[model samples]
Target: MEQFYLHLLVLLVLSILLRFLIAPGHAPEEPPLVSSRIPFIGHLIGLARYGNRYYVRLSAQSQLPAITINIFRQKIYLIYSPGLLAAAQRHAKYISFEPFAALAIRRAAGIKGNGPIVSSSSEKGRSSFDKQMKDAVHSVLLGEAMVGITRASVAAIKKSVDDLRSTEVDLLTWCRHVLTMATTDSIYGPMNPYRNREAEAAIWEFDSGLGKLTLNFAQRFIAREAYQAREKLVKRLLEYFEKCGYINASSFVQRRLEVERKAGATLEDIARLETLMVLPLLSNSAPSTFWVLFDIFSRLDLLEEIRKEIVQNALQFKPCDDSMGKPKQMCTLNMNNIRDKCPLLVATWQETLRLRANTASVRFVSKDTKLNDTYLLKANSIVQTPANVLNVDPNIWGPDAHLYNPRRFLDTRASPGAGGDRKRDRKWNGFMTFGASPWTCPGRHFATAQILALVSLLVMKFDISPVAGDWVSPRINHRSMALAISIPAEGLMVNVVTRKEVKGIDWEFQMMEGKA
Candidate 1:
């Protein structure tokens, strides 16, 4: 017993000594300021509550390329600068996506029969899935299906205005319901579940599942809600597909199945489909709508300018019909052309996302990688590229970085992010909101287009103004923060009145306008 005890004591001492040896040390000339409280829990509290402030404090203290913190039992390296982020992506193998994949796998889908969500066993499967999603976005949905969606959304918007005599409804909830209807019906097929209370309940159940899946605990164990919702939604979707003759013809489902077969991966199709909806629909749709409406309410001058522009340009395309008629053909606005003509609305949306986004990205380092001559990262170290820090940093964006100014993007002479002159061939270093590498957002165009459409129309129709007294800012919630994309961290609430008609015929005919 004495001998065994002696051996255990020696082993414990050796382990302690080894940890001390491997642990990071401060330089003789300069030491890191405000590292995580515990070895890995650095800035956890600060980040959870006051995310922007946490980075500001840390960056002010030290110009270190990267700092380490433990987030949910994982050692995450926080990369503050664009240069370091560049290095990390270029040497991606050294920084694997396996850790991030573990979370996606256990909570999102399941333990991959093949490999991680980000890493595919075969490049062909990746290419196939990418092509499928891309085709689906630009194909029938944006083409033939968009006409119905636009009509429905426009109709909903008009009704929403009429329903609001109080002029103080929760815009966030209103936007969520409207966009959910517009998006799901247009792309996924005509199940019109938004109006049906039971169907809406199912959606909430599905959303609850998604909420659970996103939790830190869920990542460690299993996403039970997500899985259960998957079964229910899949049954519904399969029935829809069969009725629509899409079971065999649909490219999206076909591609998903192919990818699974090729990579030997497993995921409930409906769950993955719903997860996809959360990003494109929820991330930008509600928050972007709120911010744009918020801006219109707060800034009279800017709102007037945009409103006039939308009236002059978009309304001119399709003349109002005298007789009651179903829209045979929807007026299509060339988004690229709109961007060329009206720069203000685009800039407004960009600035809103910059200010609202709280987190950067979840980048997993590959095993055994050297970041630079000064630093080295071991295999499977999680890296966080805090774009929020980079976006609002005064040094980078000038002294008035935090100030709300839409002109920064509109002023072509100025750089897009920094509010300076436009730089040719802009790269994805400073702007990491859409993310980087093989895992970048596919719905970027869709989100941008939807935001522009909703905002452009609303600005044209309504002369929004802020309610009396101090403004009610949104309640910040971490889950609402964009883990990989910029979204409202919590329910963003605002009060504003719609643009009342000043004795003029609205866009639609008299009866149609009344119906609206």
Candidate 2:
């Protein structure tokens, strides 16, 4: 019996060796493949160690424009070259984002089966379901609709800031609470699912569990909490729709629902998808706001500079008649003025995004295609463009790329051309904070406006300082896989006091035309 078992083990080892020996090699024109110590599982181990930073590490090692990572039977091509990325994006039909987007929607939104919710059908070869949805989102985030939403969001933010009676608070927690309330209220009106604190807590719970859910893990084993939270939020959303709660919602919310319904999505699917929408609208923005505050406050010079800019651009004081024998000062911030006039603030925002954003833009190769006239991306392969790689590339961003320099964006100079005429172009490029090409985020304008409004309000009305003697930036919590923006590992505790300059003043925010 022992001899028989030894013989069987020997045969198994021989068979595995033979299989590897007989495997086909990459074509001469294809990108070089990184060899693994153990077939199939080695790359997985590497990914586990590196997470989203895996591609950049690989790129640095290989110094290749593209590289193929084979895990089991799947192939993922990482495109590091800007030229190759542009080509891949331009060839939309052959290498598409929709298929991957559909899969993400199903996994993240908890939609069952391969539904028509993500399907594409061309009428006169014109519009697909994905295209229509994109168009709807774009339309709703522009002009009057955007203004109305921004106005509502600013109001919520103002109320939250004004009601801060406590001397000490956690910065991240405060930003999350205020930003979440503002974002949801603006989008969903009075029937916002996140309006309830329990429901809001559930949303965060669901977010923390996305990794298990995405892997299709068993709820009985690991994802029970996430599953329960998702179910609760979905039920609330479905109830809201059933009761016509969308009647008073923003056009963005109403139009999104209309588009989904027209695409033949059931109420249950819509509810699940709405839960997914909440992440992008709230999760990322809150952390981003926190980071913006941290960066500014950590450096006293930067904070003072920003405050001066805001005062010069957005802040205005109107003398009000007082009935209590004292004159009152009413302060109003025009968001339009802030957005247009505050170059340093805008630069700071951009720098923060570049430094902190770790989102990777992913797409599916629909057909066999050549990238950069070299690497052949086989059909059904995954491709990724990690924004961090682009944002930190020294060749593109100069020698000080890794440093957080807000003035990096402000140094645009036009060189002298023939006949002493100034050149039209600027040298700095490769800023992909919100992504690029067709897959760029549609809600970027609204998010930028919302964040700026909140940050501007906080700086103008409140004095904030760390409770601890000195400010130390917290390590990023990479464990929160559901969030695209990097979350701090811990909450920042700070003392907040109303700015004496803005005391006895009523604060208001207005969305001016042609601003965002």
Candidate 3:
């Protein structure tokens, strides 16, 4: 009897082990609509190689409006139909991002607390970040913020121009530094680390590890080093804060302390604030600036049009000599003036952004929900609005969707598809460069203004073009192993020359005429 019992036990143990090895539990309860067989791994073989195209293929293959994907041991439901996806986005309260493992988030940001924004509905504060964090960021927006920011940004632009006067600098490489200076100065003020290249490098090193949720062995190894780098920088920031009288109870530190007192959050919370302040100001601004310059460098016809506008506007902004024979800071053009007059300048940028932006928007489902007849997403599903797919749709954007056409935006009245108001359009199919919903990027207006300023400055000052016959635009490179949320393909490398060198340049040259 004992021998027989042992034999049965061995069989049971082997069965359990086999199940685990096969990862049967990892399988989705609802099998994906679109199925593929590439041995042990499913679509992963193609996914790793092709990235976005893999999803595009799955969308095409599924035949259904939505498709299910098994990736990273999770069941992902991708909604391909723009109309259906938009409906899902409208009712986004049902889905949630809380299903993501804490370990995955920690691996990305090197810190915890369900990210900087804690939702009230969540048991562990795993609610949507669109409301809380985004609100906090835009809370301090004011005309005063613009004044300092514009001044610093303009100063940085002038400095970069001076530095690159004799050199054939990569516009993207140097413009990032200029943006870093402007943004950091505006946020951190006196303790700005713009001049400290080492500090800037460290910050980027730490930022690199953010946004991946996978914690596989290789990922963990990279995360370990990233965490170390994060710790080093966090320590430095803390020390800097202390040196700025934080330890001695200055206003800034005291304000933070007061928040801790009210909310009972810890020193970790303060650290989070530091990270939030730094990142929001750095990442997007740099890329936006780079793309504007890249567009100008690659397209000479577009560049000349923008140049003409800038020179005209610059001439208008050139103040008549005051009684003291001093030029005023600005020539009195306001926001309304900018919108009404320089449509081409504005349209060119909008067109470029549409071409380069990854998608329309992304929203985390706040609860488990169903969209349409097909998808039954679990509580914490990530439902992305297929902006890239929609933006390039031949049916919606017409046959010329792939071509770069600034006139599309310039002649909105003549546009067959001016669409509708943002919300209504978003409900169907719309552009999502700044996302949608309450969590839409608050700094988008500011970002647009700054990018326009940078572009205007470059156009006014430089004659930019691609490197001769080698001037073909660089293919957007998104296939790198980097897992950051807003990863941009490597920027287009191009050459820029001063406006004077161009043979048939059109410019009023207001700044040159009266240098105080």
Candidate 4:
């Protein structure tokens, strides 16, 4: 009798454990597993060798809308179907992004584990550090809070363009430098640490080492140079704040300090957290701006059309600069008008993202969840919505999906056919580069405005030609594993001469600002 009771108790305990890790027997089935030929390590090798393309190629192996990839015995729901991706997003409360965010900061900052779950704001003042930081970040980077920074950045861009002189330059180097300077000057105010040469270089170095740092596995030895680079930038940032740099900073920086201080974070903690804020400003935005310029310039017809579009639709003229005693109209380009009115320019931007922005919207399933009543995701699963896969999926984008077709978005829609009801399934979830609602990038509005402004000015105010003598698309740097949008594998040399017509004429950027 004693033995029977003990056996029954053990069975009950095991059942409870299993229940948490899996769904109930009556629940929906988990996504179908796509077994690999080489078994356990095949997918790992594929990822290391092929980088992001591994997932794209893997889709050919299975017909599942979503596949269960076995990563070292852990279930990773690699969502391929737009419908499943939407469902996962809808059940965000259970398939959470917060835990992963907290983990990323914990690992990258070298902080001791302080619990990996970022509490929901619904709990309000109970505020875990990550939750507080998220709230503070959203306060200024999203909605109406973005106008001040947008205005300042536009002014900076206008000044940079006005100073442009004919010169031979590397396109990537120029884009990174110009965009970083313009963006940081606006957000960091007068004491912007990135203005210092060492601090400027350090941001890129830290970013290069970010992949290893976020893995948090003996990163000091493996990514020594990058680790030191981060420390150097952190030191400069610490000095910036100690000297009351926040006094003149953008609301984004101000809110960051206010929230972290309230959470009793140390100065170092605040600096480290701010490091993440400075990331997209320098990292993603520059490459995106570079691609847009490269694409427009490579096709002269497109360049002229973009220039014409801006001139016709976005430009406003006022008699402000009559310095030469010859009447001159100072042209003001309304960047918001460029964003809204120029369909071709907007389409070009979207095409570049679809083709080159390789990223996955990753989440952690903290509780058993049903995705649109069709699929069940168990707790302990990792969910990844790979935009790289969906962006080029033939089913969603049609037969010519692999090619860059800006016309696809001229109607403000994807090429259609993402499965199921097809009409309703073709929603915003199909575009995952900036991700979907709730987890959508907070800085996207500013980034878009900045990129469009830079492209608009370059095409309109200057005559740029490749030093190679014609337009040749450089191959992407495939080995840049840590980055989402890869940079050019080779240098693109260009001659930039201010157009004769625009010389000596003052031009200003009229930025349209509202909700982010």
- The best candidate by lDDT is 2
Question: How does model 1 fare in lDDT?
Answer: 0.54
Q: What does candidate 1's lDDT look like per residue over 1-516, in tens digits?
A: 999999999988885575466455433322122445544344567765664456656766677767765454445567776666667778865564544443553444333344423346666755565555456555534454344444454454455544444356566677766666555544443443234554444554455355456563643346565556555555555455446533433333344445444544434443344344434454456666776677656777877777666555545445454357533322333444344567777778777766665656776765656555555665556666776777776545557878888776665423345644334113234555666654455555555655666666555555544344445565654443444333444554445544454222343311122111
Residues 1-516 of candidate 3 have per-residue lDDT tens digits of 999999999988885575356532322433254545642366678756765556556655765556565544444666656666556756745653334433444444445454333323454444333334333445434333444454455555555555555346655567777777666655556665334786676666665555332343454565665555566666766666556634442232344445444444445545544553565556666766777676666777877777677546543543355467764433332333343467887877776666766542434555666666445666444565545555555555567978888776754523223554543343225455665554355566566656666677566667666554456555554443332122455555456666564323222212111110
Compared with the true structure, model 4 gives a TM-score of: 0.87
Each model's C-alpha lDDT? 0.54, 0.78, 0.54, 0.77
- Model 2 misplaced stretches (Cα beyond 4 Å): 1-25, 113-115, 118-127, 322-326, 412-429
Q: List model 4 lDDT by residue over 80-118, tens digit each.
A: 988787677688788877766666776676655332222
Clash-forming residue pairs, model 2: none
Q: For candidate 2, which ten residues in a row score worst on lDDT?
A: 420-429
Q: After aligning candidate 4 to the native by TM-score, how far in Å is the CA of 223 from where it should be? A: 1.0
Residue lDDT tens for model 2, 285-345 = 8888999988888888998899999889888889886777687878888888887888899
lDDT of 4: 0.77
Q: Which of the two candidates, 2 or 4, achieves a greater TM-score against the reference?
A: 2
Selected candidate, larger TM-score, 2 vs 3:
2
RMSD of each candidate relative to the true structure: 7.4, 4.0, 7.5, 7.6
